[model samples]
Target: MDMFEDDTPGNAPEFTVSELSGAVKRVVEGEFAHVRVRGEIGRVSFPRSGHVYMDLKDDRSVIAGVIWKGVASRLETRPEEGLEVVVTGRLTTFPGQSKYQLVIEDMAPAGMGALMAMLEKRKQMLAAEGLFEASRKKPLPFLPEVIGVVTSPSGAVIRDILHRLRDRFPRKVLIWPVAVQGKTCAPEVARGIAGFNAMTPGGALPRPDLIIVARGGGSLEDLWGFNEEIVARAAAASEIPLISAVGHETDTTLIDFVSDRRAPTPTAAAELAVPVRGELLAWVAEQGARLTRAQTQAVETRGRWLRDLSRALPRPETLTEGPKQRLDYLSDRLPNALRGLAQRRRVTLSERGALRPALLRGRLAEEGRRLEALSARLRPALDRAVTAKREALGYRSDRLSLRPISRDLARQKGDLAETLARLSRAGEADLRRRRDRLGAAERMRETLGYKATLRRGYVLVHDGEGQLLRSRDAAAAASGLRLEFADGNLELGEMPARPVEEGGDPAASKAPTPQKPAAKAPRKPAKDEPPSGQGSLF
Candidate 1:
């Protein structure tokens, strides 16, 4: 057994370290170069030169790997520890260290089996944070001034978005390109969103008013980077509004859940950014038609206002001044009416004054004339009546006076005629007759006287009392006696004797005395006397 092991034909003899490394390098470059392998990543490091260094392994074995700066920068993501990946690179060996490893160029997810496990875990964490809630989503702006886009720079998604936006609305657009998948793809997407926000410090973007994250259609494992919590939270915290257009219609990511708006694809996301050009042009035409109608209505209002102003202006003089004309007419008529009334009153006053005085004076003069004529006519008749009464009285008085005187003259004439007739008839005889009558008358007168009676022989005797003796009884005896004879009276010397008583003394009584007797003439004797009639007998 020792002799066979030492003299081995199939196995070569032992050499220096450089010779061993030289052989492995030839094999790696020649035969097993440019191959793809599936493994999990472990022990990752990014050096200062921007190259990525890590290990690729399975549960049984491990391998070293390197990605250069230029190639790694072009990768969709960085490789990490414990991540399942598909690496596209060639096996290589370092001659200085005498080590054999992998030089990575490109990679992808390992498989559906590995990707599903990681996606399910990340989806649960986002759901717990409420990022998948429908309520957290924002509505898209109707008209945006700036629009944002996120995709690979060389992808068809960005070209399609620009074409649609320029045609619809010529507003601005901003781009933030990032890797959409692999180990470090979530962090790169988050950085792209953050960079877009940083360009607008005060929420004013230089490129977009709204943000859109976009990519072409892919499998669920390829879209896993958008489902990461870091990418979702970056989208949610963006000040600008976010729109997600990640993959195909069936693709739903955590970024889509937190975005302000979600579109089914990249083309649809462009439509949300602006309006349609054809519809906007039509709307402008309709507003022009409305402007024409308003102008016409304003003209009609002005015309009506002018018509009303014309009606309100002042009227003509002929229509408005009727009252003033009536006032002038009354003014002209008033004075004449007053003057006519005054003249009528003056005439009435004169007529009444003249008629009253004329009537009174005429009556007075007529009455005076009538009274004077009546007085003159009565004076002659009164004078005639008075003269007639006086003449009648004088005639009656003369008749009475003449009757007495004539009666007296007639008686005297009768007496004188009777005397004359007697004288003529017997002058002597008449004388004698007259003498005889006288003598007879003388005788009769003598008979009445005592002395003449004595001549006729008559005597008277008286008693002593001197009374003619009518009776003896009436004489006193003692009284003296008286005797009357035809021629004279005789006184007795003593009382005549009387009869007495016989016894008386006769001597003492009266004595008889002698007295001369009265002388008597011869008396005529009466026939009856006796012869002794010489003495008174008794």
Candidate 2:
């Protein structure tokens, strides 16, 4: 054991590895309780645990540092490799590794030069990632129903925005309170943008159509929160058009590079959100007046052209003047023309006469003799025809008689009566047969009824409501029972107790104690007959 031992230092107390590390940790933390280290970051790492681990180094010396999950999330700026930062924290030891490191509580860019350099580096990275692409930016709403402003609620920025909006066109504004320039500013601003986007559009708290991220003018360090990568990404990803108004006109941040629009100040953002109501109304009135004048002139022009076209047409009476003159001339010459024509026709008839007076008398006498001869011949023929017709009529009258007709009618009447009598007998027999069948069916139905079963010593037990109690348990549970027999129905006031077994006392087993069934309202009788027009039961 002596050979394995090392030379001991003088006046030194023994300590385990944990004990030594703990002592060194206490000493370093006591000496540098609050320190500000200025160095460029190296080998930065962010784990899924949300803790940030990095190396703070200058020319030759390097110290390991860590910002825990809580501090990391609230930090306005992230630790980046090669970025110069001023860290405020206390020195502490890692006992597990027997080494010392800084437990950083706060972190920021070292100076204005470092901040601008960090901003330019971040801008280049985001630009390369297409976050600043013009195509991704949404167009601003011409007039938003609700405008959301993300800024400090107590700050002058919100008041300025509200005043500007009211002066132009009044709109509902949703103010998301946030710290504008601190460790929590970036996270709060990012969350505010996301919260507005997450709201349901037509809900009780209406979603804003346009979002304005605003803050009062401040130095570059005060405005550094808006330059955070998280805030820039949130602004770029907003579905609602976002306007960035973080500082004065000369001031710009990473958010302005990615936002849909950029305003110089909060008031300017409000102006961009809406237009003057009075000016809009004036423009609309002017357009309406111009449309009215154009319509009136068009109608008047059409009327004047129609009036000019009508001047070329002639008068109505002139169209019929020639026809009336021809009618008058024809009326004047009609009677004289008719008289002349009649005189010419009479002369023509006298010149062309076929017979003289003597010849005419001879032809008349000859025609009279011819007519008399025809009359003399026709009279004899007519008399003979009359005699033959008389004979034919007498013979026909003798041949036709009423006796045959009367005989035929009498025979038909007798046959009809016999047929009617046969039909009556057949109808009566059919009715009797049907009556016998129906009677047999009625007797069979009665034989097959429940009363027959009762007569054979099977009693039907029914509950108070007339439903059959088919089991012993059911009968025992019932309040009252009806015993239906062939003779009559008997009602019991109460359900009987369970009967004893054969091996029990003979007296208790002898009979079920008679239960006085409780009085119950009687149920209506059920229908017995089937519906009409059904097929024969048989």
Candidate 3:
């Protein structure tokens, strides 16, 4: 029978385009509801809706395929042109285009060996471009004020990282949530790294001093996103120091090679970002003590030198004593010497007058004239002698005077004393400053100690084996436990039950103010409980 032949006008079968298309869709979709197809991808395209459309083809046949946005986002590896892959999806028909296609739910490389080869090839290509060069790597910051984290927020990886950071040194963490292992992981992580670098420093949003791209331990297929070239390039080009912590210590990814630092795990990455506050404080205190000691020793040495120099210097009175004695002797002898000279001249004149009257008169006149001339010359000679002696005495007096020496010595002593005073003042000031710093550091250390926290109404619960309890479950399971209060400890048989109130509201049961524990006799252990070791609360 001819199926399309119209036998009669009234009895002819008719159908709308929608009815025909719906029938075809049902038949095609039912036949290939669930199937796996192996082919090389071709002409892959993404539209505004994020759906991936592509052609899957072999030498002899071709088929159209699509991955919806939600499913496409979850793919571990994205589809690439000419790449052989195995895709699992359901076959469906689009009524508008009158075509049949596979709606891909999942995809993977055709083989593990093929994927490895591709990864190695990509690594080689990136290496050739100097992306993995040692010179390209930047040094990680010793202390980062703001740390940027790229990871999945819902995963345990971020929580582990934050906990580790808090334990070491608390820092501001900016979390950029992204897929850690999927088709979108590479692009999202790359964007996150670049976004941190693009932020302006000291702006409304603090720029990260360090970036950590982290993911938990995963299989090679699951970690492949971190090995993508895009992620590697982004890490290499980051202005801020980048740390790649993609998997466990044994795992290595391409981004690890390109990053400035590679941490064995996400927690280790957080450790690398900042220094421990306690250790840093200890170091500062040590340095301050050393400085104070050095300055004090220097001041003491200088003071000793000044004392020795002062003892070696001559006194002003000792230097002037000789000149003063000579002046006194010269003053006492001058008048007696002049008197003896005048008496001898008078005796000579009397002897000449008694010789003759006429002749004596003439002789007396000549003698008187000669005596007068001699007297004139003698007086000048005496005066010159006195003047020469006076000048010599004056010269000696000037040379012996203590004023010049005292002035010079005083100036030198004043300068030395001033210098010493300044040095002493400076050393004392520096010592005081260093001591203050050391004290402050000690206070800070005490403040940050766990004992201080315990005093604030917190307690430390330890098991019978001396292991600290971290959770309520662990505390409940222990056979015997020690409860540490601020002042002392108590041995308990088991975890204490919470006290209830009449209203059944937990908040209504108020705890009494903490007080010093009173001394008490040791209680005998219960039948099921083990004896606990006794220790100080601290």
Candidate 4:
């Protein structure tokens, strides 16, 4: 009848402090094996071991809460001081601390409305700081040499982006893996953005010309981290142009406003980042053709003008007529001058003969002999001069004969050189174009392959016979299964039976209810596997 009867010291069974604590822990854990507690968080602390310790309090009572490192990392929303949250976990006593605490497994903000309100408040604060100002936004690069991505390494979002980039244009993508929608999401995303900006432009890790902050579509609560003030501020302060692709088209976050550009989806962000390589190559070819045509037309027009000017100029014969006439006049006067000299010499000889007969006769004989000798010398000299002149004329004629052919050869050589240069340029252009196309094709093949999909967190499930299992029912029915991940394969034993709910209606249970298979841990893609996406012109 008395509750204190068991407390009698003489009849009571003894227990050490350890046993008492252990018993208390078991009872408490069993009673609260699964519970959901809604309260405001306070005194939140993240220890060096990565566990979170916090106090969950209501208006009247406070409860100590603890999130293990793994569970804390998986929380959709972090337990922050002054944040209204709902946590699900089991309650157990920490014997050393002499207190009962909640071992939280999952946590989230109280409601979507509450999260949105918080998001709005943060947005307002960032706006006041001018982080969302249009003036602060940088223009996206027309062609980014390297694109930095802050996103989950294993998600459909990354795959979509890579695939889209490959379809449009390929660029070097540097991925900074982070939690997209969890307790560490904001900080990790912010860190990724900052880390990219911190890199040296041409260092071992090349700096990205553009940045993309991306995540898949989720509920407002799941996407709340993008609305955090830290993320917004980081995006605003980034030196590299950033594109925000937090969620679907309608799901806007603070990052969307602060980033240089906002894309409706991750794929859209990739599409905006670079130009299609094929199209760029085509454009280059078009411009080159236009240039060639313009040059050819200009050359033709100049040549026509030169021909017209040549026709309008005087002839070579007309230019040489004066010199020809002067030469002819000199030739005609030479014979008359020689005849006058001969007549003058004859008159002088007659006068000398009349002065003295014998003396004059002897003198005349001497004069005649001297004149004959002089004439002989003059004749030989004239013959030599004629021979020399003939040889000189032949030499000049021979030189003249070769001049035209040499000039023609020089002109042909110049034309050939110009042709060869043009051909070389064309060849280089073609080679460059082919190389770009080959690269694009290779990237396309990679992007379109199943390996890329696997890297995006998809797994191919196979039955014992190695046939692909498409449905959850098929997988559940299979005796043995194999899962092919991006990096490796996992062989699974028989599927476990689903536990029937107690006190449930049998008829209701008999109705076929579709069940989804549990998701497996994602594996990173093998290094040997090619990355997704085609190439674009930078």
lDDT of 1 by residue, 19-76 (tens): 7677768867899778998999889998899989899999999999999998997876
* Candidate 2, position 31, lDDT: 94
Model 3 C-alpha lDDT per residue in residues 1-538, reported as the tens digit of each score: 5435879878877888998898888888889899999988889999999999999999999999999999987787877777789999999999999888999999989998758766887888898998888987888888889999999999999999999999989999999999987678889999999999999999999999999999999998889889888898888889999999999999999999899999999999998888899999999999999999999899778766756665675654555566556655765555555555555655675676665566756765676667657766776676676677667766765665556546766887999999999999999999999999999999997787766777799887887666777776777677667776767767765434453544687666656655545434355345334225433446
Question: In terms of TM-score, which candidate is strongest?
Answer: 2
Give the per-residue Cα lDDT of candidate 4 at 531: 30
On the 0 to 100 scale, the lDDT of residue 340 in model 1 is 59
lDDT, residue 233, model 3: 87
TM-score, every prediction: 0.39, 0.53, 0.48, 0.45
Worst 10 residues of 3 by lDDT: 527-536
| Candidate numbers, best TM-score first, in rank order | 2, 3, 4, 1
**Higher lDDT: candidate 2 or 4?**
2
Give candidate 1 regions above 4 Å deviation.
1-128, 132-136, 201-207, 301-538
Candidate 2 colliding pairs? 492-517, 493-516, 493-517, 493-518, 494-516, 494-517
lDDT of 3 at 497: 43
Any runs in candidate 4 off by more than 4 Å, and if so which?
Answer: 1-110, 315-538
